[model samples]
Target: MSYLDHCSTLLFFVQHCGARGRSIGVLWFSLPSWAELELGRAPVFWKTMNGLPPTSGESLTLFYNPAASNLAPNEEFGIAFNGGFNQPIMCGGEPRVMRIKERGEADLPIYTIKIQAPKYAVSLIFSFTNGVEWDGPYKLQFQVLKKWRNKPIIFSNEGLAEELSKEGACEGAIFPDSCDHRELRN
Candidate 1:
């Protein structure tokens, strides 16, 4: 399958699993080598903090480094979430439209948008975007904020488990059935 096809498949799965009340702790975006060169490195989870409660008009803000890899003199990069096409949150400068792909399955519509030359800290304003109120029991919080220096944040599954443990939220963590050892041993 083509790279775009692969992305679409993965996105569909993520949305599907999320619809089933599964909170995706980590998401890996597989970009083609060329796209990677243009978009920089894979996304890293910087930090997770509390946001406005459900009752509040606005929620959490997720600050992340959009691009940590090297970029050409004027090369641009941007990220699109599964939601409405609203104004981009300017961290340093305004967002320029790169591309937009409209797609739908059954009755669900999806739009893939790419922004050119976005700020290092790209803020996803939930209040302005269109989507579900929350992902599973957790409200959709976390906004991206710009940093003085662009440094990549590295994290692992173990680190995530530790964070959850510290929060006392890992007690009921569920392992996927696909992780069963019987098939692996076979």
Candidate 2:
């Protein structure tokens, strides 16, 4: 099989196997850096959490691409809380959804949501929407770790409000490589 075919097969396998929230072992394969980038650009049905190991009572920035689905222009992308150990998973009394806009000047409009993680929550469950359809019941579990580590935000979850103040939405995927969940441990 050609390299692109292998990449497509791997993506299909990951998409199917990754949905159930079951952790999968990472399969290592050698590929040129350019080929890896090519594979990474293919959009996948997963959400991106700006920071790693989401903690309780902190800023959580999330991105969703409406172009990935057959969403109408009138539809608003949003998140619905599935209830959690602490009941509400939002802090600072923010709304469930922020808004949708273009990250750059060109690309599919990405839906950006910002919330303060609940201080008392141990886990979170939520889903995505394009006003007409739903995407996930994605779950996140948090642990109290003594050693602190932080992953740099791969995508800029910043300046969303200002961008919304301006006109138009982006036309493509912003961070095609960032995938947040394949599994969640209960």
Candidate 3:
């Protein structure tokens, strides 16, 4: 998880760690490929984590290549999730079908995807592409929680007094000379 801090914009660095357990490893230096790098930097893509930790049966929206990652006009961009491969996002009861929305900054094409998060899934894995080549096996972990009501417990003062009298804490416990169970009853 390394980043290049360029003018406050953090660019993600792809550290290809081999089968080793640790992320620290030798950097496999190589020439830049058209699909991997752009303008001396990795083609940047955007994803939203606002609806994360979503319970079962919730829809999440993800935006890809909103700013950078200049794809060729003919190149098609798509995402593959854990459940399916190269699946099209369902928008307004219809699949967007590789359509680009030019509503992003600088009129850049932003690919939107809607995911129906399942309750049984532990994590969501996503792979992206630009028609010519593919990038990423980006993972989004989930913390599944049971649906529960927010009920606060309130203890009655009279109930506390009755319980304290039954225990008589100062009898066997160490305390100051002024310590008295009667004071707690009051």
Clashing pairs in 2: 21-183, 102-170, 107-170, 107-171, 107-172, 108-171, 108-172
Q: All candidates' TM-scores?
A: 0.21, 0.41, 0.39
For model 2, the run of ten residues with the poorest summed lDDT: 168-177
Model 3, which residues run further than 4 Å from truth? 1-53, 66-73, 76-99, 147-186
Report the candidate with higher lDDT, 1 versus 2: 2
Q: Comparing 1 and 3 by lDDT, which wins?
A: 3
What is the C-alpha lDDT profile of model 2 across 69-174, one tens digit per residue?
A: 3333344334322222222232212224435544465655555544334333443444454344444444444432223213222211222222322322111111
| Model 3 TM-score relative to the real fold | 0.39
Measured by TM-score, how close is model 1 to the native structure? 0.21
For model 3, name the residue pairs that clash. Answer: none
Output the number of the lDDT-best candidate: 2
Question: Quick one: RMSD of model 2?
Answer: 14.5
Question: What lDDT score goes with residue 47 in model 2?
Answer: 27
The lDDT for every candidate, in the order shown, is: 0.24, 0.34, 0.33
Which pairs of residues collide in candidate 1? Answer: 61-142, 61-143, 62-142, 62-143, 62-144, 63-143, 63-144, 63-145, 76-117
